[model samples]
Target: MGISKHSIETLKQTLDILDVIGSVVELKKSGSNYVACCPFHDEKTPSFVVSPVKGFYHCYGCGVGGDAIKFLMEYEKLSFVESVEKIAAIMNFTLEYETSYEKKPDFALLDEVMRFYQKNLLNHKPSLDYLASRCVANSSIEKFALGYCGASFETIKFLNAKGLNKTEALEYGVIGKDSVWEYARFSDRIIFPIHSPSGKVVGFGGRTMSGANAKYINSPQSKIFNKSKLLYGYYIAKDKIYKQKKIIVCEGYLDVIMLHQAGFDYAVATLGTALTKDHLPLLAKGEPKVILSYDGDKAGINAAFKAAKILAASGKDGGVVIFANGMDPADMVANKQINELSDMFANPVPFVDFILQHIAKNYDLNNPLQKEKALAESTQFLHTLSPVLQEEYKPTLAHLLSLPIHLIGSKRLPQHNPLTFTTPTQEIAESVLIKTLLEKPEWIDFALEYIDISLFVYKRAEFTKLVANEHQDSALIALMINERIRPINDLPSLKEHLRLFITQAYTQILSQIPHYTGMNLQEKSILMKEIKTKILQLKKGELLPYVSSSTF
Candidate 1:
């Protein structure tokens, strides 16, 4: 059964927009509305305005204005259904729906699987013996959710009995569907459950028990699982990551587990996929810095370099952490001096240093031709950085390559401005009008009388309908309802431009209305001419001048 629409609405009614937003953004009272720095963009001034009267928000700086659901969708980067489910849970609302679909696998089954693995570590002889030989501690086993599956397939049978069919369990990569039921996935491996940010078991990754062909196997994509967007151990480490404002990104599950065991709780790793844009934002939530602790192998170094380029492009600080003697983090934790590992983290090297150090190991700068090649490659990489960062690195690269400082500086780079993209006229108008109404509702009646509703396009039609309702609070309330505003998303630039034009038109219409009341027929005609002239001038990029005494 799925949630009902009525229940969803009821949940929304219980949760206030101001309270939800206040949880994330700092808000201060300003007359009847509240103001804060817009969370969706980088800004120094307080441009985000919230109005309890209208039950909506608008950001003058970025032109993002909408109701609570819209806010949740944007703020959390969630799908519409996901946002509704989250808000429904927060409001303690029970959904009512009936469906003929088969019952979905319960989360308790995953819990039981984890419990079985834990019990196996303590009671199962083969599992216990395997951990002892590897020098893996009982405490570490428990911490990493390390467990063993028996020689038999009891775990599979147990899950099957709990409403999970062979196909569904196999979909989650828990068991195989072959007639033998060959313990589908983890035959005898250490299991690691991947959890969503909200703490639901979405998938798993398992390490082989023996020195086998495949080292690791992860769950395939399921309804709730996506490999690119997920990082192993993020749910548990998010708070620490947020507090420390730094995250240690490693290659494998054991590497992350060992780091946590070593008191570096802010470590995370990709789930069988390369670091992506989805991964970048989640890391950005904690801090704008990432340390790539990849293996010392050529593949690992190449992955780290690629990740560094992406992080740098997104305006994040990132670098590679090469192991001292071609060791992975897990091996280092188990075999190397713990103090040596600790010292490396404590005295973290800059990304540039790591890049130069690695290059030095491979290139012979004593040869003039080799030196020139190194300079060109390193200079190209440095050039990709922002102007400010490029300037900072110029002197360092010059000294390292033993080249004239101006050599690198001679290459011109393109400057990036985020605001170069303009918004559509419709969106600009809608946002502008919404902001104006929230600020001064008295102009609503004037706007309704003078502005031609037909002038507005699709989204503008909804706004016009709300205005024509002839009820003050009711019209404002309509703005709080969430619906897909099509064509707006398709043409975002036009939306932004529309908001500006609409806001200016609303202001002009409101101001001109009061002056027209005292004018005779001749005076009214002159006023109309003046208004037309002003509109034409405005279209030509001229500012509106103040009107004093009427010439007529």
Candidate 2:
């Protein structure tokens, strides 16, 4: 059994494909459809088109076309069911799953294991005392579902007797087996159960209270758990993140928990992995600013620097909070330095400024060679910023380097152009047709008569919708007018564009006629004759096509 077809169809019906695609890509209405640079590949000029009427998208450059679900599957790397669940979350739709086929281990079982760990922590006095020494409050412990496991084999026996599958338990990293013995993997350690965004416990993270080889160990990546994608405490911190429009990302689970307890509920942690590209979409939800809270140590500083670059490249606004030597968020809270931590969060250095400071810290300004090297490195990094931001920070960088602002270039350094165009003139013609109907909805019907609907490479759905509604959609018209770089201003402009589009369409079709290697001599001759006649009429200053409908 699989996900119900009805659910997928219902989801497709409720979702606007344009909205989903627009959330990731900066889409502008060029004509009947929305256009943006294809996210599937890097290109400056837009070849991606989203059609709301058709409820799908097509990228002429990369040739990736799909409905909403397909787009999610490719963009987010989610499986079919995962994509459905993601969309369901957006639409607030409840999905019902089939029962006949089972996939992966049961999450319900994982919940029971969590309960066992929690109970075990209660009985373990030394672990509780250790937590207390760290200034972990009882309320915070309960709120975060903190737990522990005993070091004895009896714990495994108890779990086995409770009908836990040995394979499943091992898969979740809850238990381990060796040459002739079965043992609990995380014994004598405090357990932090990792919950999914929906609040179901998917895995556990264990920190050693005693001397262990690794100070921290996490559950292996299972079907339900992905360390790279899961942000610690995200399920709990999401609401606070939305309310504040910011997220505090720290280095460890204890940092996140302590920050929350100290009244900064927006903090979360990475699960033993540095921030990655996969984490961006999760962080970008609700469009919140990010603050990286790391230690002052070299590893921490390097991690913070790397994360800041990722944030900048993704166009996210954020900063950094480097905790002082030998101090982390947990240590700060444990020492009752809540006020100082609050101040650090409040006054985080903006990402660009933080990067600038980080770069300058390595080189002495007194040495000419080092100063020049620092300035060169800073200039190259600053070039990655948006044109507006690059301009905004130029003066600050100049003052820091003790150099004139003009020494740093105002424009972005030229880079190689990787994008190539196909039939540039024809694409422009297709764009004009779409852009005209969008700016002046009233002309949709007139354009429909003279221009074949199939001639539109973008905004075909918008064109179809306008025609169906009898050339009326104030919302669509407003969107087009607001989004256009320069809109059609008057009736004469619209008429002129329509004439140009018709001429270009005939010319493009005529050019492509010979490429129809599949056509016989009679078919080729007939198509060429019709196209030649249309071109002659267009050259004669005919404003409209003689043909009533599209023949191609």
Clashes of each: 24, 4
lDDT tens digits, residue span 1-552, model 2: 577787678877888775466556655554456666789998776667676665667675676777788889999999988988777765446665676553333576788888888998899898899889888999999999999977758668778789877788888777878898888888878999998776878899999988899989999888668888789999999999999998999999989998899999999999999998768757865678899999898999999998998888666887999988789999999888989988888889888888888888889988999999998888888878777888888898888888888887666644422123345665545555555666566777766666666766655665566567633343233223323224567777766777777777777777887777778888878888877887777677668753422344
Scored by lDDT, the top model is 2
lDDT by residue (360-406, candidate 1, tens digit) is 55678889999888877776776666667777877777778777888
Computed on alpha carbons, the lDDT of every model, listed in order, comes to: 0.65, 0.77
Q: Write down the TM-score for model 1.
A: 0.63
Task: Give every collision pair in model 2.
Answer: 31-434, 31-435, 32-459, 33-459
TM per candidate: 0.63, 0.69
User: Candidate 1 — which residues are off by over 4 angstroms?
Assistant: 1-3, 9-109, 129-139, 161-163, 178-182, 272-274, 326-328, 331-339, 356-362, 409-552
Error of 1 at 212 (Å): 2.1
